[model samples]
Target: MADATTIVPLNPDEEKFLRALGTVMALLPRVVDADMLEELPISSTEYTVLVHLSEVPHHQMRMSELANVCGLSLSGMTRVVNRLESQSLVTRQKCPEDGRAWLALLTNPGWKMLEQAWPTNLASVRRHIFSRLEGCDVAAAAEVLQRIAAP
Candidate 1:
């Protein structure tokens, strides 16, 4: 392996790609959150949490696992869940199998909220992302993005 002190420079195209990726990483969430907040009662992060919970069995997931999937810290996830809980959209219960852990469970209201928000979310995504990719090979781009996102 090269020494840690060694300097490596990106080519112009690589530099441009990295800059664009960084911008998107910073901007996409804010744009989507704005759209979601305008037309729905929940922010993008909360919607994302609900979406993940809805996909799992019993509409529940361990709190830590939920945090991981949501890309939030445990404390951040707790705050978000607390908000959802306050709205009657989700509930938290101590894990039966692991007493020290907790689980976030989606409520009936949460499902309804997701259902109500789907169309707005779809329109936002299509307008902000798909609409701009008219001539691009989307599947190939998705594969590249997936590879980059892989752990």
Candidate 2:
């Protein structure tokens, strides 16, 4: 009987792509966590959640939608909202249109945080990732990733 665990070889392109992805993955967290956002008023998780809310209509998104946009689980988003609520960065409200749903509302403080974080964040991203790529290639890659992640 053939052993299912026998090695399955990756094609050259597959191996190359995985290596490229691995390199980026290894560098991303260290840069983002250490140099980019540590001094910011919000953690990356909080910032991403706020950014998602900031783009929503009236800066209010139902909790479930916020979770999907932020790549967070429902309970994770709830905890983030709880922390932001304590800091007055966000407000939690019951959805008027759906009594069972909760909405995440970006507050004035949250907007201010976003304002301060946005430029610096972009700079860090550029220095770490975008600046190294050819402009056209970077743009094309971004479009591809966006397409893959589209709802």
Candidate 3:
């Protein structure tokens, strides 16, 4: 292993790429969240939770697992689920397989909410992300991102 105090300088291109990546990481979520809030009843994070639940079998997932997938702390996920539950969009139940754990279940109302919000989410994504990539190879970009994000 290299010495902890050793310094390796970044090339100009590498430095530029890192700067742009940091800015995008900071900006993208705020922009998307703003768009979602402007046109829909839900924020982007809430919409994400709904989308994940909708895609899963039985429209249910463990609360901890949901937190992981959503990139939220367990408490944060609980709070989001609480808001959804209050709106009658989702429900929390004891995990059948693990009594100590909780599960998040999408409700019929949640499906309706997702269906209603789909267009706005799609438009927001296209407008804020894909449109900016006009002539870029989107597939390659996605593959690179997936690799970067892999555990």
Q: Which is the better candidate, 2 or 3, if ranked by lDDT?
A: 3
List per-prediction Cα lDDT, in the order shown. Answer: 0.94, 0.83, 0.94
Model 3 lDDT per residue over 75-138, tens place: 9999999989989999999988899999999999999999998998899999989899999999
Q: Order the candidates by lDDT, highest first.
A: 1, 3, 2
Worst 10 residues of 3 by lDDT: 1-10
Q: Once model 2 is optimally superposed onto the true structure by TM-score, how far is the C-alpha of residue 71 displaced, in angstroms?
A: 1.3
TM-score of each: 0.94, 0.81, 0.94
Model 1 lowest lDDT segment of ten: 1-10
lDDT by residue for model 2 (1-151), tens: 6587986889999899889888886878678656545677566678778788888789999999888877889999999899889889999999999999999899999999888887767777778877778556777898977986788
Residue runs of model 1 more than 4 Å from their true location after superposition = 1-6
Clashing pairs in 2: none
The C-alpha local distance difference test score for the whole of candidate 2 amounts to 0.83
Question: C-alpha displacement of 111 in model 3, angstroms?
Answer: 0.4
lDDT of 3: 0.94
Model 3 Cα shift for residue 28 (angstroms): 1.1
